[model samples]
Target chain A: MNHLLLLLPLLMPLYGAIFSLFFWRNVELQKVFALQSQVATLVSCILLFMAVEDKGILTTQVGNWPAPYGISLVADMFSCIILLAGSVTGFAVFMFSLQGLDFPRQAYGYYPLMLFLQLGVSGACLAGDLFNMFVWFEVLLICCFVLITLGGSRPQLEGSIKYVTINFLASSFLLAGIGIMYGLVGTLNLAEMALLVRILEGHESLITMAGMFFLVALGVKAAVFPLFFWLPASYHTPPIAISAFLAGLVTKVGVYALVRLFTLIFVLDTELTQLLLSVIAGLTMFIGVVGAAAQTDFRKILSFHIVSQIGYMIMGLAFFTPYAIAGLIFFMVHNILVKTNLFLISGVVARHYNSFALKDLGGVYLKQPFLALLFAISAFSLAGIPPLSGFWGKYMLAKAGLELKAYALVGVSLLVSLLTLFSMTKIWNEVFWKKKPDETEVALLSPITNRMLHMPVVMLVLFILFISLYAEPLVHLAYRAAIQLLDSDIYIRAVLYQ
Target chain B: MRTIILSIAIRLLIPLFLFFSLYILFRGHNHPGGGFIGGLIGSIGFIFHAMVHGPQHTVNTFFRINFYGYQHQPTQSRSIYLMRMMRVNRWRKRKRHYLERRNRNRGLLHIEPIDLIAAGLFVATTSGMLGLFLQEPFMTARWVSFYLPFLGRLGTPLLFDTGVYLLVMGIVLKITFVMAEE
Candidate 1:
């Protein structure tokens, strides 16, 4: 029963995508089907979490095969928590996509591809083997490629090409790393490999090398530091729906993979790797925020901020303490929701104002105060204002860093948070508070009803407020997930035994 | 522009391709052949036909034969036939309604080759769900060892393979058709 529950999230999307294809002509049915599937996924994830809460960790071998020989699906607290967050984001994005995506693109199999992408994400999070993780990533990436290029506009094509090329390179790096690990350890199952890594002697350097490959691959995906160029170039070109979904989920999956790999399988040479990660974390935070300050485009600024937020998550991982990991977990869930909401709000603004350029956009506060409020809530939450979801994550991370006496990294994190606020303020001022351009013919664009556009954003904003006012349960869950992550033995034993 | 030799050769080869595809699909029951390869081969038949006779003709013939066939038989009195049919079957209204809705959709948007892909996917997913009733996990293979007079050992995997075959072919057909259209 638990095994079926574990498979439900992944399979729901798979079947949804398959069946959605059959309903291509009836776009309404397709949208409802996709939305229902996402809702079902959300419920299953909740159920999985409840089960995990009761059972400690749930593991299932596909085709009734035992672990080590068959593909395994394991959901510890960490995986279940992330899957839950992902499904929530998925549901929100599907709601947004229904009215947000243009007709031609929607007709081009948008919902099916989105479901396929969700399948990839769910599979990646729950995959108990390195090879399966890679395959899942490929599935996720392939769907993204099609989604990004769905419209076949010049800019979309250009962006997709860059996105595809860099991602392909990253996949190669991941595969190379997986191949090396398999060669060295003679096993692909993560639990078996973790056991092997502990028992095997004299292969620390090789293991570290493989770990480096995984880092580089995931770093590119997470858009950390130098590898982040492809993100801003490509993310702003797709339809706002696709951009919002990608912004919310894609890079976070990278962070999830990074944290998973480092904490679970690649624990060797931690001092050196952790030190290196801290440096990257500091750099990633600083560079991302600074870059955001220079962007005038709404989605582009959010894209840069995505890089910065990732840095904070990595910082949590870098601290390598259970507290920091807990913080990272909280930060990831918060960022995914907040970031997706911001992008969706941006889409609404772009639709109304007929521009993504902040310079042309103005008087949003005067005209649509509610949209402005939604943006402010998400943007401020993103910048770590007190009592909001982001604040708790940052607080946990900062305290964790201070405990480790990593003052420089802690200072950088604080500085980055401040700069993130500056960037958000820049957007708030330019896009919302500034005067509308006189020459712009806002009347030329047909009026889109606020209900379809604002519904998802409003729901997300309410969610942010809820998480903020009631952070205790979430914080506790993150803490528990972190503890489970730190104690790798329990995860291994669960997978092996069950 | 019609090349007699090329057209003739394609006509002969199309059936052979289809025959080979069926052979491959049946062989997939035990051997390496399956729905995917069969679908590929079958699609190749249509693709070849398109290349020889043009995609427009291929599409017209295919749709005409499969989607819309003559419903009312040619009679000395059309009114009498219609009245008799209407009186004979009250359930015909639902069928007529379905056809009307389908025809309306067809007028709204010409069905693209991608529709085939979607149908193929639907089939694949349905076949995979056959195990759901047995408390097995999704897509879990359930086999039945029954011997036929001519064939042997049928199972759910064959259904799955057929689904895969159709899906792959549909996808390839959609892609190739779109490219050709452009």
Candidate 2:
């Protein structure tokens, strides 16, 4: 029964995707069925989280195979946390797709594809072995390829080609990394490798070589510094709902992998890795914000900011303090919700104005103040304003940084936050506060679309508020998860000796 | 494209190819042959038939679902408007001749490749869940108490292999026909 609980999140979405294919004739039924599956997944996510909270950590060695040999599905606090946030945002994005996405794309297996994407995500999150996680990422990538090019517009085709090429490169890097790690460690299982890394004693350099392979591969996925060029170029080309989904969760999976490995398997030489990661984090922040400042498009700016916010999470991981790691987890969840909401809001802006360019968008403040307020809450949260979720995350990290006495890196983060605010304000001034453009026609939104677009954003806003207002429980949870991560024995024991 | 000798030869060879594919599919699990190779062989049989007779004719005989895809919208004006768009190359004009042939040949049974994919996924998932019903973890193989006369030790793994077979066959045929249509 316990193992079943862990499997529900993956199974629900997989079943949903399969069944949605059966209902290809009726798009409306497909929509309802997909929503039902997502709801089931969300329920399962809650159950899994509760179970993890109660039982400490849940691992099922698949088929009763001995540890390190068979596929294992494990859910620790961190994965459950990521799963919870992902399901909520996934549910909202599914709702938004009903109205936000155009009809033809919906008919072209969009709902099923979305469900498959969810399966990939939960699979990646829950997987206990490195190779299994890589397989899940491939599943996730295939869905993205089709979703990105569903319309087959010229831009969509061009963007998807770029997206595919870069991701394939990343996947190869990851596979090679996995091969090397397996060769060096003789095991692909996380817990087993953690134990082996401690025992091997002499091959620290080769291990770090494998770690470098992962860093570059996951760097591309996470859209870090030099490797992030594909993101802004392609992310803005997809439909807003798809963009929001990808922007919100996909890159973060890369970060999740980094945290998992660096803290667990790649800890052989933390001194050098820490310095290297902090520098990368700092440069990623600076370069991302600088790029966002240059973009005048609504979704484009948000895409660039995705890269920037990731740097903050990476910084949190680099510090390796319990508080910093806790902040990293907290910040990851906070960023997912806030970033997805902002993109959905951008979709609303694009729908009404028919343009993403800042100059052509305006008068939402005067015309649709409700939309403006929804936009304000999320955008402001993203900018790390006080009393919002982003602020708490930043506060935790900065406090951790201060405790570490990393003053220069701390100063760099604070400056990056300020520049983030500048970019958000730029969007605010141009998209909402300015007068409506004189020349372009404004598209009217039907009541259903109006409801569909705002419902998800509003739900996410409530979530952001919930997190900010009721901070202690989640904070405690993240703190405990952080402790669990740093003390790797608990995980190894749960998987190997349980 | 059809030649009388090739068409007659395909008429005799296709059934043999299909029979060998099923034999190969059943031979999977303990041996090397399995769903993927079996499906490839099955698709090869059809491909040969398609090359000799016609793709439309081959599709109509086996599948009981629509294979004609979403309508290709006439983009006469839009294509011109798109700066990057170019006219369909004349070298690909043979694609149109097949399209015209597709309209003329109507089969009573026609299955879309996507339908096969969906059905295959469903079957594979169901087979995995069967282990769950038996109180085993997902994708764990569950065999019957008694063996079948030919396919010995009927099990969820075999069901899973069948699903993969259909899935692979569907994928290859879909790509082949769609490309052949265009």
Candidate 3:
């Protein structure tokens, strides 16, 4: 029963993709089926989360094979919560896509590709071994390739080619790292590999080299400072629905992988590595918001903000404490919700204004006060205003940093929050408060599309509000996940049954 | 642009290529040849046919389905292979031409590439669900070892393989046909 729960989240989307592809020509059927399957995926992940919460870290070996010999699907608290976040965002994005994805793209297999991407994500989260994680990452990258290139527009193609090229390089590095690690440790199962790395006598420096390789690979995916060029270039070019989905979920998966491997597999040379990561985290945070501050386009700004927020999550991991890890978890989940919602709302605004450039967008506040309100709620939450989800996350991380006497990083975090708020206000002023452009025409969405768009945004906002108001459960969950992450012995035992 | 020898070679090789693809598909259950490669081989046959005769001729030769109904009628004038396969005598040339023209106008077969995809996916999913019904994880390898009269022992994995084979073939054909048209 437990194994099936772990498999269900991945399989539901796989089957959904296959089934939706089978009915490729029937766009309406595909839409309905895709949404239904996403909901089903959400339900299954919730069930899996419950199971994980009740039973500490569940591991299921595929084909009844013993762990360390065959592929295994394991769910600890961290992976399960992330999976839950993936499913929720997936559901909201599919709902948004129904109205947001235009007809030609829908006909061109968007739904199937989205489901495949979700499958890759869930699989990546649940994978119990190193090679399997790499495979899942490839699957995830391939789906992104197709989704980004679906329209065949020149910009889409240009962006996706860059996206694919960089990601392929990252994948090669990841593969090389896995190869070196396997050579050094003699096993690919993460649990067994951890044990082997600890006991293996020689080649300590070589293992550290492999660990650096993994960091660089994941760093590219997570859009950290120097490696983040591909994200802002590519993210804004895709359609709003695709952009929203990818913005919310994809890079975060990379961060999740980084946190997992760093916490569990690469525990050697902790102080030095943590120092290196802390520096990167600070740079990532500062550079991302600085880039965002310079952006005029709404989605482009959000894309850069994603990079900045990733810095915060990495900062939590770099602190190398249980409180910090828990804060990272809380911050990651919160960012997924708020970031995707912000992008979705931007899409809605674009739908009305007929432009993503902030210079051309205005009078939204006068025309639709409710839309303005929705934007403020999510935008403020993202900027770490108090009593919101982002504030709680930032608070926890800042508290942890202060306790560790990382005064520099804590100050950097505070400065980034202020810059983030400045950018959000800039957007608010330019896009909403400014007078309408005289020549530009603002179109109203069809009642159905309006309803569809509004539902997901409202639901996500309510969810964030709920997380803010009643954050105790989420904080507790994060704490437990953090403990499990810091004490890798629990993970090893759960997977290896030792 | 038709070369008589080239056309004849294509006509003769079509059956051989198709047979080879089937062989590859069947062998995929145990050996390395499986759905993806078999589908590629089959698509190579159609691609050759398209190159030799022209995309329009290939489209007329193959049938397709859209959301509504059959996309093309498989008949003598439209289907070049069907026209050549007929055994009309010289004495009945005029009447044969009329009949062939009429056959061209008639809908002899209504098959579409999408049907293969839909059927293949359905079958593959069903085979996977069989494991689920048996209270095993999805796509679990379960075999029935009983020998049949002619086909021998069959396993669920083979069923899954066949489904993939059909789906890949359908997809290849669909993509090749669309690309060949323009």
Q: Model-by-model lDDT, in order?
A: 0.85, 0.88, 0.87
lDDT of 2 by residue, B96-145 (tens): 55654655434234456777988888887788786577676777777789
TM-score of 2: 0.92
Best by TM-score: 2
Model 3 TM-score, all chains together: 0.90
How far residue A120's Cα lies from its native spot in candidate 3, in Å, is 1.2
At residue A82, candidate 3 shows an lDDT of 92
In model 3, what are the clashing residue pairs, if there are any? none
Tens-digit lDDT track of model 3 for A270-297: 8778998999999999999999999999
RMSD of 2: 8.4
Ranking by lDDT: 2, 3, 1
TM-score of chain B of 2: 0.71
Q: How do the residues B17-84 of candidate 1 rate in per-residue lDDT, one tens digit apiece?
A: 87888779878777887888899998897787776666655654453323243256765488876676
- Return whichever of 1 and 2 wins on lDDT: 2
Off by over 4 Å in 1: A439-448, B26-36, B62-115, B147-152
Winner on TM-score between 2 and 3 is 2
